[model samples]
Each structure stands twice: as C-alpha cells, then as structure tokens.
Target: MSRRVVVTGLGGICATGANVPEFWDNSKKAVCGVSVRTLKAGDEYSITLPIAPIDGFEDRLAEFGRDMARADRFTQLAIAAADEAVRDAGVDFASGLGRRTAAIVGTGIGGQTTFDAAYLAMLKHGRKPHPLSILKIIPNAPASHMSIRYGLNGPAFAISSACASGAHAIGVAADMIRSGAADAALAGASEALLTYGAMETWKAMHIMSDELCRPFSKNRKGLIIGEGAGVLVLEDFAAAKKRGAKIYAELAGFGMNADGKDMINPAVEGAAGAMKTALSTVGAFDPAGVYINAHGTGTLLNDPTESKAIRDVFAAGADSLVVSSTKSMHGHLLGAAGAIEAIATLKAMETGVVPPTINYDEPDPACDLDYCPNEAREQRIDLALSNSFAFGGLNAVLAFRRV
Candidate 1:
C-alpha cells in the first residue's frame, strides 16, 4: 500500500493576522484586508493604489539570525510561517529530524524588491551590488533560510509557479514522503511584492482594484496585491502515529498539471483534469464529500474560469458542493494563496465552521456556484480541496480529509 501523508501542524502570517487564531478570527468575521494604496520603495509610481499591509513583520524577523538587510520580503514571510509550523508540529528540533526533515517553499517572484533597490543603486550610487544581493532576491532564498535556521539537512529548494507555487510546493513535498525521500517536510509559500517595481509590473498588466475586492461580483474589477506566508508540517501517517503526534487531517491527495496552452489564460480542461486526479487519488470521487476553497482572486477572468472548472470536473455534483473564497477576507497573497487556504481548510475541519466570503454584495450570474457568501457556516466536512491557478498556465489541487 502507498504510504499515507498527513498535516501535523499549520502556521500562517498575513494581513488578517500574524498567528493562526488571529488569522482565523479575521477570516471568520469576513473582514476585508484591502486598504489605501501607497508607493513601494524604489518604485516610481505616478499613481498609488490601495493595498493590504502586513504590520509588524520586522518584529517577527528579529527572532531569527537573518539580517534584515540580507533578506527579501518573501524570505521574511517564509521564516515567520515556517518557525510557527515547526513549533506547532511538536518537532524536537534538537533531535535528528532537522537532518532528515525537508524544507520546500515557493514564491511567484523572488526579491523583486531587492532587484528594484539594487538597480536604482547602480544608477544613483554607481557602486557594486550588495554582498547579499544574490542571497536576498532569489526565489530559493526561503528554502535555504528555513533549512539553515533549524539545521534541516534534507532537500531544500523553492518552487516557482506564480500563484500556484504554494500548492506545488506542498504537493511535491508530500510526494517526498510517499516516495521515501524524507521522513518529514515543511511545505508552504510566502510573498512580499509590495515594492514599486513589483507594483509597476502588475500595474502595467492593469489588474489592481481601485477600491475593494469582490470575488464573484458582476462588476468585479482586478486583483488586489497583498503579502504573507503559510506553512504546513507534513509527515508519514505511520511515523506520526508511532511518535504520538496528533494528525490534523490526512494529506489525502494532490494533482498538478500544465495547460500547455496560453501562458496567462486559464484552460478549462487543464484545471478540471487536476481536480479529477486529486479526487481519484484520495478516493473522494464522491463529490458530495468534498468542500472546495475556490481560488477567487476577485479578478474577472479567475472567478469565472474557476467556476467553470469546478463545474466541468464535478458536473452535477458541483451544485451541492460548498465553496468559498477566503481570499475575500485575507486578500490575495500571491504565491502564498494556496498554502494559507489549505491551512484554512484544515482549520474548518477542526472547528466545523467554513469561513465566509465577504463583500459579496453583487454576484455574477456566469460565475454562479455555492460560494457560502457573506456568512460562516457550521457543517461537517469530510474531504476538502483547495485550488490554485497561477500565471504560466500552471494549476494545482490539493485534497485533505478529516482524520
């Protein structure tokens, strides 16, 4: 039989809250994180837009030995989330686990802020790049920092697939245990792309919301950029049981696929294929048993595309399924979106309360589905799926089951 993998602990830091409880409290109330916009450091924006800010991130960074100057915003978020996840998993850090434990994190754009600063320095100061420039801005910096912090000697690297990066990271790490590559793994994603250069890139694409984020609204605008990190501690079920570790939920299945079509446009068949693969792997093919955490970036293209994808996979079953975009509450955390939503799904199972999608005043007819709009619900959920679609036509789906 294939080895079973499960989530032992969860940690997340975002605009909603820095810790799990605070994050949940904000989510449960359907609070909106999108706020007034401002200019990013080293960016020259003729216009500023509202964005969700994560306050006190620097305070969290002080616990580790990483120099603030040597780290990127994405790495900072990763350290915070990974530290909490490791502690929550009841990991004996001093034990040999770090040597055996794997660290896999992801980021859509690594160190855009650092790149922005260094380039400006070249023009203004006419000086050489900073010593840590290479370290701070790479996408893999999060993985390296996490491994160094806890002495994890196992495989460590960052996966980049745009917004789908988090789900891909967690899914691949779970496969590590399934294939005997590692005993335990820390899998997640973090992103801090509020820099002027980052903003300019997205602004050029014309995807920022002028006011608020409305996921399924008929008049929905574009995505609101936000920042945060989320990490999960995964281990083999047999090993966790032997160690007397509590299993939050089984990491039942994962599905990954590429559209092979347009790099930026969503593909209906690609998204549905991943969902079907996940259901089959987890033996949760019975659609009634699953709740979906929709990608729901509040962008017009994403919301509708996701709705059709869900319908295409489950067909009639999609009608009865429970789906919500907690992104409505937390805003979009770019690459961290999937991991944090997975954590939210696990928390919903633990507490029997599915968070609501707030600011749902206007609904799009074309994007119709059971979004659990505007209110939290008490329901017994057995299996749940979190879907993430990213740039470059990458898609990932994860399955979690009540233990």
Candidate 2:
C-alpha cells in the first residue's frame, strides 16, 4: 500500500538570508540580493559580476564540528541546512529512527571550489593537491556528510540534474517514503559555485545578467548566479501526525519529463505535460486557485515558454492563476533553486501572502498573467506548484497542498 508524504520542516540559506524565515521575509519584500563582487581569477585577471553569495558562511562550519579546510563549500552549506532542518523537525535520530531515514541531496557542479583550488595550485603554484581532495570533490559528498551526521542508514544518494536536481531529489525521497522503503528522509540541494573559476566558466556562457533579474518582463536580461542550500524534512503523514509533528504542507504529487528535442531550448509541450501529470496525480483542482513558483530565470526564452505552458495547461483559468518568480530577489541558486523556491511556496501557503516577482519593468505580451509584481499580495493559497526546468531540457514539477 502507498503512503502519504508531508513536509515537516524546512531549512535554507541563500543570498537573502541564512535561514528559512529570513529568506521568506526578504523574499516577500522583494529585496534584491544580487550584487557585484570582485574576485581574483588566477592571480592575473579579476572578474566582477552580479552574483548572490552568502556572507560569513565560513563561520558556520564550526557548529558542525567539521574542519573548515577539508570540507567543500557545497558540503558545508548542505550540512548547515540539513542540521537546521533536522532540528526544526525535532526528530530523535538516536531512537533507532535513523535506520529508517534516508538522505538525498542534489548539486549541478559539486566541489567546484575544491576542483578550482586543486587546479590553481597544481598549474600555477606547482603544489600537489590535498590528499582528501578526492573525497571532498566528489558529487555525492553532501549526501554522504548528511547521512553520516544524521546517522541515516537507509537509501542515501545524490542527484546531479543541473537545475532540476533539487526538485528531483525531493520527488525521489517522497517516492521512497510512499513505497515504504523509508519512513522519513532528509532531502534538498546545495550549490556553492561562486568561485573565480566557476564564475569565469559561466561568464563564457554569455547568459549572465549585468543588472538585476526581471522575470516575465519585457526588459529582462538574463540569470544571475547564486549560492546556498535548501533542505526539508519529509516524513510519512500518519507517522508525523502520530508524533505530533508540526506539518507544514502535504507533498501531494510530483511530475517530470524531458524535452528530448533540444539541449538548451525548452518545449511548451514538455513543460505543460509535467504540470498536467502533477495535477493529475492528485486529481484536478480549480486551476484559478493554484499559485505557481515559476522557474523564472529572467532569461529571454524561459519566461515566455513557461507562460505558454501555463496557458496550455490551464487554458482560460490561467488568466486568474497567480505566478511569481522569487529568483528575482534571491537570484538563481542553480541546483538549489527548486528547494528554496519550494520553501517560499510553503511559506506563502502558511502566511496567506504571495511573494512578488521583483524588478518587473514592463510586461511582455507573450507572458501575460497575474505575476505578483513589486509588492507582496494578501492571498491565501491552498495549492501551489513549483516548477524546475533545467538546461538539458529536463523538467520537474512538485505539487504542495496546505495541510
């Protein structure tokens, strides 16, 4: 028999804040976190870009009892977020519950900091890399660290599907619980690729915006890179209620599909299909009441394509649905984007205020919808959808209903 899954706790750190409450508060106010930072590329060239980075995160490593020099930035961020989530959930890991718990994290480019440091040392400084570099640089290090810290013995692994990684991780964790493979799971994603090398590489892609992100706006430029982590404590619904856990929201359904048509370009059919599958899993609801946490990267193509997909799926009801992109404030956290955005969605459900998509200059005719722009609106949302469309045409959508 299948089981139901619910989000018990949320933890996240981003440019806007170092925890979920702070992130949500700053996001609702449409406070922009993108800023210009200058960093040494390779002792020769310095690069500056509008990027969102967490400040003073290094000091947080001491709380986890981890060696700051050994742990990769990504892993540190994940551990911090996971610790906050586990504490928020008030789960007793020592009560043999660890055996039935799992840890699943996602990252697009894991250990980029380690790789960049190793290469710079070897190529420029003629120094050999640290012996533990391999362990720290691997993509699964975050999951491993989280499992070890929390004593999780059940299924533990990592997903690396670019931007969709976080949403995919949560979906897979929910499936594991529903399938009775695990009773609870720590699921989320983390990314810390703001190093000089990583930024230089992204600059070559020519998609970095010089100004702030403005999704669904006619004057939108492109996406800004951000760094942080977002994690949720997912538990079986019945078990959570029995234990008197404070349930945040029900993770009702998940849907994903691949375009299989292009590497970077998005297809409306694929996007619409994913949304339809998610909604169908939980039966249909009034489309007008659903709020969408859009995968709005403020790019030239994503906004219009996503708007078209919403119209395709919801038809006339799409005109009443509210859609907003928190990325306009937090910047795109890459693999961590969906996880943080999911937290934003849940917080919206709890608070009855929909966060706005900031920096909206002018509306595009192709992207006409009720995008809560510039200011937070007072609206109670019972059901919400968080969309994550990755660069490789991979799309993942998650459905959440207020409990």
Candidate 3:
C-alpha cells in the first residue's frame, strides 16, 4: 500500500478566528485580534499588557461532553478543533478507521492554568491542590483525551518542542502514515498558556511586545502571547482519494533539525537547512508561486535571522516569493503557532490569496523580503511552506502543494 499523506480537513481556534473559515476570512481582511487585557493571579498580583485571547470559548464547553469539560483548557481547545476537523473530513472512525488512526497532539506548556492554580492555592491560600491536578497538568492530557474521545487505538502521544511543537506533531504524524505505522492521523497542537504565571514568566524574559507584533519591521518590538488550538485531519492519500475525500493539499515534505548552539538564539544555518531539506521532496517549483508562512516572531533577533535564512534557501529567487507572518494578526500561539500557520499556508494556497503581515510600519534593510505588507495579496500559489523555529533552536518546516 502506498502511504502518501494529505491534509483532508483543517480546524483552528485562536484570537483571530474561531474556526478555519473564519480564520481564513479574517486573514484575508487583515484583521488584528490582539488587544490589551489584564491578567491577574490574585488580588495582589496583576499585569496589564497586550494579548490575543479567545474570549467566550467557555460557553462552548458543553458541546465537548463532560470529559473535555473536566480536562484542562488546552485539552478542551484541542477537542473543539478536533471535532471540527473530524466533521469537516467526514471520516467515520466507527467504521474501523479509529483503530488505524493516530492522535498526536502537541503543547509547549501543558495545562498551564491548572499548574498556576495549583501552585497559587498551595502557596498562598494554604490549600491542597486538586487530586486531578497531576492528570490535568500532564503534557499528554490532550493526546490521551483525544484518543479516548475519538476511540483511536493507534499511536497516541504529545510532542513538546516549545514553539515548534505543532509543526513537529503534524510532521511526525504524517511521517507515521507514510511509514505504514498508521493509515490516518489527527495531527495538530493546542496551547492555553495565557495564564498569569505563564504570562509573568514570558514577561520576565523581556521578549513580549506591549503593543503590536510588527514582523520584519525596523521598529518591531517583540511577540505577543496568544492562546488557541489548531487541528488537521491527515489521511493516506490513496485512501482519501479512493473515498472521494475533500483533499486540501498533499503533505509533500517535512524537515526538522536542532541548531544545538544556543537555546535562545535562532541560527540561520539550521533554518535554511531545514527549508532546503523540505524543498528537496517538492521537486522543481517556481519561487513566484511559493508562499512562505514565516516564523517571523517580531522579536529583536528572529525577523532578520529568518529573512537571511529564507534568502539563503531561495537565493536570487527570494524576491520572487511572498512571505508573511500571520502572527502579526493572530498573535503568536506558541505551541499552536505552526499548526495554525500551516492552516493559513494551506488556505492561502487553496484560495490564492496570501495573508498579510499586518502592523508593518517600517521595513528593516536586513529584512527586505516582500512580506505582502499590511494588505493581503492575490496570486496563484503552487506551493506553500510553514516555518516554525522554537526558542531552543528547534526548527521544523512543512511543505504542501495542491493535489
């Protein structure tokens, strides 16, 4: 059996959009979901800053059943996204597909809200943590919940690679399908780390923007934290085609590597190498038709580094390609960044309208690539790549092409 992989459905929820269609629509409109909000750990501790938060998501918890409601917010978000993906793919797991499907969800910081509450309660309130705190705080909670929820009996687990977690999970799931380890997979990531403790920790690093995320801009401040989940239903290409599935795009290539140099600094060499490796399987492609969903974190070090990497990979043709950071609109989803960005990439390819890198006030000389500026561009897209580079120099790139 040939084990080629394809993305049949995409589901996502974020500060930008509640689902894939909404996300794509908002992307085309260049809608910015980031806003100023106050997060408080207790009465004594509070911080106000710009954040991309998905408000009113709690109202939808009843639809996920009791188990998901009891799970952490990350798990809930994952289930919500997965529900949409499974429906959109029209896959009937009850018809023996569940046994051969894998649930591979990723999270950079699992159950952060639960962890924060537990510590705060124990330290300040003189109270014991909940008995289910261990289970809730486990990184694999979302994966396990998904497996049980979907009745999946194949390989089920979670990947934690900081910001690269989503891309790593999706790529690994596709690889498993290609290797005959599974026939299909629920592949994506979820993150709900906008809790007070997580925010404080991120603020301590001095890498968060107080206002907007302006990627590739000369006056770029830093990334803003966001919370949400993005899920994709991936299946074997042969099987999906045989069943007349609505194929979004073929999962053509994946490349991952660790820089091994510094935890904080991203290396241009590692990023360029991964991108090259991913393109290795893509055959010959026109740079003009390529759309790169860049890992443009809008930070002091990331924008220029990523620009140089893209230029190194594409060389003279770099100017022909269009690159954008949807993070400028949705804010950085941390672990969920790659999954949603992959969706954005696929949507751009499918619709032939590239999302804009919004909030781009000033351009930097070092980052001279065409970012599509503050407005979305309409162009034919034959290939798309979603770039994800984590804080630990973990790099993952995914390539997709129309089938």
Candidate 4:
C-alpha cells in the first residue's frame, strides 16, 4: 500500500536570509541579495562577479566543533540546515525512529572549494594536499555527514543532476516514504561552489551575469551564481497528524524527464511534459488558480522556454496562471534552488502572498504571462508547481497543495 507524504519542517540558509522565516520575509519584500565579490583564480588573477553568498557562515562553524573541520563547506551548510529542520520537526531520532529515517541531499558542484584548494596545493604550489581532501571533496559528503549526525540508518544517498538535484532529491525521498522504504526522511540540497575555479569555469561558459538577475525581462543577460543550502523534514501524513505536527503543505506529486536532445538547451516539450505529469498525479485542478515557481535563470533561453511550456500545458488558463521567479531576488542557488524555491512556494500558499520576480522591467513578447513582477500579490494559492530544469536536459517538477 502507498502512503501520503507531507512537509513537517523546513530549514535553509541563503544570500537572502539565514533561515526559512528570514528568507521568506526578504523574498516577499523582493529584496535583491546579489552582490559583487572578488574571486582569486590562483595568486595572480582575480575576477569580479555578482554572487549571492551566505554571509558569516565561517563563524557558525564553531558550533559544530572539531568534527566539522574535516567536512567541506557544502556539507557544513547541509548539516546546519538539517539540524534546524530536525529540531523544527520535533522528531526524536534517538528513540527508535532513527532507524526508519533517511537522509537524501543534492549538490551540483559539491565541495568545489576543497577541490580548488587541493588542486592549487598539489599542482600550483607543488605541495602535498590535506589528508582529508578526498573526504571533503566528494559530492555525497553532505548526505553521509547528515546520516552520521542523526544516526539515521535507512537509505541515504545524494543526487547530482545539475540544477535539478534538489527537487530530484526531495521527489526521490518522498517516493521512498510512499513505498514504505522509510517512515520519514530529511531531504534537500546544498551548494558551496563559490570558488575561484568554479567562477572561472562559469565565466568561460558565458552564463555569468555582471548585473543583477532580471528574469523574464527583455534586457536580462544571464544568471548570477549563488551558494547555500535548503532542507525539509518530510513525514508520513498519518504519523505527522498523530504527532500533532504543523503540516506546511502536502507534497502531492513529482514528475521528471530528460530532454535527450541537448546538453544545455531546454526543450519546451520536455518541460511541459514534466509539469503535466506532476499535475496528473494529483488528478484535476483549476489551472487558472495554480501558481508556478519558475526555474527562471534570467537567461535568454530558459525564460522563454519555460513560458512556452506553461502556455502549452495550461492552454486557455495560461493567461490566468501566475508565475514568478524568486531567483530574481535570492539569485540562483543552483542545486539548492529547487528546495529553497519549494519552501517559498509553500510559504506563499500559507501566507496568501506570492513572491515577485524583481528586476523585471520590459517583458519580452515571447515570454508573455502573468509573471508577478516587482510586487507581491495577495492571492490564495490552492496548488503550486516548482520547476527545475538542469543543464544536461534533466527536468524535475514538484506539485504541492495547501493543507
């Protein structure tokens, strides 16, 4: 028999805020968190780009003590977010429940900082790297550290599907609960790729924007790289209700597919298919009333492709459907984007206020839709969809309904 899953707790840290509340507050206000930062390529050259980095994260490392010294920055952010999520859920993992809980995290470029440092030490400086470099640089370190921290013994793993990593992680974790593989799970994603090497590579790709992110805007150039983590505690619906947990929203459906055609370009059919599948899983709903947390990367291709996908999926209701990209405010969190955007979607449902796509000046005709631009809207969101389309044509869509 299949079970239903619901979100019980949410915890995240990003450029906008340190936790969910702060993140939501700043999001609702449409505050731009992208700022200029200097990244050193080695010891000689430095490049400046607008990035959304979590401030003061180094000071918080002291809370975890010596054990964290060996973990990478990405894993550190994941552990901190997970700690908040566990505490918020009020789940006592030590009381036999730990055996039934799992940890699944996602990362696009995990431990880039550690990798960059190790490469520089060995190749650039002709010196031996740190002994723990391997442990710190692996993409699965976040999931492993999270599992070890909470003593969770159930299925634990990491997903790394470019930008879709976070949503995929959450979707897979929910599937485990529905399949009775686990009663509950800590699921989310983390990214700390704000290293010089990572920045240089992104720059080489010609996707890094110098100005602020302007999703759906005609003058929009590209995406600004950001780093952070977002996590949620998902529990079985019956178990959560029995424990009197405050249910945020029901994770109603999840759908994903690959575009098979291109590496970086997105396909309209693929995006539309994912959205259709997710909504189909939960039966019918008023398409006009649905809101979309778009994977709007402020790029020329993604914005219009996503817009066309929504139009194709909703057809007549496309004009009434509201879509917004909080990435315009929080910047793109890459692997962590979907998880943080999921939290924003649920918060919008809870508060009856949809966050806006800031920096939208002139909308392109190709991307014509009701993008809640520049200001928050007072609307009741009965159902919402969060879209994540990655570089390798991987697409994941999640559906949530107000409980």
lDDT of 2 at 196: 88
lDDT of 1 by residue, 1-403 (tens): 3689999988899989897888988888877787876675534434478777698877656676645536988888888888888888897756887788899998888887778789878976797778889889889998998888888988899998989999999999999988888888999999888877778778788777888777887877878888899999999899889899878899888999999999778888888889888887766355665689888888878888899999998889999888998887778888999988988888887888888877788878888888888889888789899999988889999989877
Ranking by lDDT: 3, 4, 2, 1
Clashing pairs in 2: none
Compose the digit string of candidate 3's lDDT tens values, residues 184-280: 9999999998878889889999999989999999999999989899999999998999999999999899999999999999999999999998998
lDDT of 2 at 192: 92
* Per-residue lDDT of 202 in model 1: 87
Winning model by lDDT: 3
Q: What is the C-alpha lDDT of each candidate?
A: 0.85, 0.90, 0.93, 0.91
Estimate the lDDT of model 2. 0.90
Clashing pairs in 4: none
What would the per-residue lDDT of candidate 2 be over residues 1-403, giving only the tens digit for each residue?
6999999989999999999888888987788999999977576867888899899887766777845447899988888788889989998878988999989899998999889889888998999998899999888898898888888999999998899999999999999999999999999999999988889898898887998899999999999999999999999999999999999999998999999999889899999999988887676677656899999999999999999999998999998889999999999999999888988999998898899999998989989998999899989787899999999999999999877
Residue pairs with backbone overlap in model 3 = none
Best by TM-score: 3
Model 2 has how many clashing residue pairs? Answer: 0
True lDDT of residue 52, candidate 4: 89
